[model samples]
Target: MIEIRNLKKSFDDNEVLRGVDITIHDGETVAIIGESGCGKSVLLKHIIGLLQPDSGTVKVDGILIADAKEDVLYALRRRIGFLFQSAALFDSMTVYENIVLGLWEAGERDEVKLRQIATEKLGLVGLGARSLLDFKPSSLSGGMKKRVGLARALAMQPQYMFYDEPTTGLDPVTSDQIDYLILSLTESFSTTSLIITHDLFTVKRIAKRVIYLNKGLIFFDGTPKELEQSTDKTVVQFIERFVK
Candidate 1:
């Protein structure tokens, strides 16, 4: 389980997350939705140790993350996989190489085992052995790169997956396909997911629970059914705009 207590952060003067408190249980797909600059991404970064909160605590599976020791932080990171907004694959490496890079960087130099696992990860994302393993990230289409990114994230068999705006730049059909892939993979692997998105369709399709943030506060936290029936004007508007 992941828990945030009284989390707060600011950039010099502008506060982003204001005394935020939330808890996400295992095997749950929780979507965090808010307007731009609402600090949704900031929350995800805190969970991953990319950003530290000015005050409060972030605990993952009983480990304190906000201010963990370096070794502890590294250990925590190994258990989580992050898919960035841009896919973040290396331009010079082949798709297979990209997937294996994390393992290599972690000091796993057993080529035979790495290759086997990388191949399995590729297949998990609906890619075949014949998929261009030698082609660099620059050679792949947008959707293909996204798939490769997903495969890389899965290579570690992370207990948690963090997706930042998974559907931002895609067409409707492609976005839905990505959403389905995320939903299917999370269910099949039983991995906890924290998705930060403004996409309501993606939220309705994949989120088991939803958190609506406004002006740096959690306006609502509940199941999708509850979200759809919320009565607050802001919450109601968000639901109508996205969940409908």
Candidate 2:
């Protein structure tokens, strides 16, 4: 579980997040939604220790993420996974190499174990055998790259997963596929996930709960049905815009 309390952050003279509070339970899928520049990504970064909050605390399980030492943060990071908006895969690395990079970098050289984990992760994302594993990121489609990124994140068998704009530039079909993959992965791994996205459909399909942020504040926090039935003008407008 993760708890964010009175989280605040500022850049120069502008505040990005203001007194935001959120809690994610173990094995739950929570989606963070809001208009652009509402600090959704910043919030995710803070939770993962990629950014520091000027004021407030991000607690993972029982430990305060903001107060943790560098070594402690590093160790904590290994138990979490992050999938960037851009897929964030190295063009130079093959699919297999990308999937297993973290384990190898952590000096996990048990060839048998490495192969076992890599194969299982790739299979989970619908990737074929080790034959295509040697292919570079450039050789794959956008959706395939996204799947590869997911495979890489799963390689660590993280207890918590964070996704930043997972469906961002993809077509509707592709987005739906990715959402299905997310749902499948969540059930298979029983991992808690924090998905930062503005896609309403994605939120409805994958989020067990949704947190709506506006101007750094949590404007609404509830289930999809609650959000859709919300009378709040902001929530209404937000949902209306995404309605096909």
Candidate 3:
């Protein structure tokens, strides 16, 4: 389980997250939504221990993230997969290399095992062709890059997957495809998923629960249906903008 309590953080003069509390149980998919700069990404960083809060705590399975030693933190992070907004792929590396890079760095030197890991993960994301494994990120489309990133993340067999703007730049069709992939993979792996997105469609399709952050606090926390049906002004206004 991931537990966050009264988390607070500030950068210089800007206070981002304020007294935020959220508890995500195992095997759940939670979507975080809000305007840009409303602290959604900031909170994600806190959860993954990339950013330490000035106050409060973020605990993963009872381990305090802020207090963990470097190795302890690394171990925790190894169990979590993150897909950055830009996909963050190394343009120079081939698809196969990208997928097995982590395992290789961790001391898996057998080429056969590395190839097997790469092939299996790529198949999970529907990129199973042996030929494409030689293609670099620079040669792939945006959606393809995201899939490769997802494939790489899955190579770790993470217990938790964090997706940052998973469908940000894609067309509606591709966006829905990505959402389907996320849903399928989450169910397949039974992994906890935390997605940060401004897309309401994705929230509806991917989230079992929706968290709306506003002014450094969670304005609403409930099912996606609840979020859409909410009568709150802020909720209505936000939805209206997306609905149009």
The whole-model C-alpha lDDT of candidate 1 against the native structure comes to 0.88
lDDT of model 1 at residue 41? 90
Candidate 1 TM-score, C-alpha based: 0.94
lDDT per residue (tens digit) for residues 1-244 in model 1: 9999999999989999898999999999999999889999999999978998899999999989966899999888988988888999988889889998889989999989998888888887777655667789998878778888988999988999999898888888889889999999988989999999988888889999999888888888998778888788988776675654
Worst 10 residues of 3 by lDDT: 123-132
**True-vs-predicted CA distance for residue 180, candidate 3, Å:** 0.4
User: For each candidate, C-alpha RMSD in Å?
Assistant: 1.5, 1.4, 1.2
For 72-150, candidate 3 gives per-residue lDDT tens digits of: 9888988999998889998889998998888887788999989888888888887776457889899999998999999
1-244: candidate 2 lDDT, tens digit per residue: 8999999999998899999999889988999999998999999999978899999999997889878999888888989988999899999888888999889988999878887787888888888554567788998888888888999999998999899999999999999989999998888789999999999999999999999999999999999889988988889898897664
Alpha-carbon lDDT of model 3: 0.91
Judging by lDDT, tell me the better candidate of 2 and 3: 3
Q: Specify the highest-lDDT model's number.
A: 3
- Local distance difference test scores for all models: 0.88, 0.90, 0.91
What TM-score should be assigned to candidate 2?
0.95
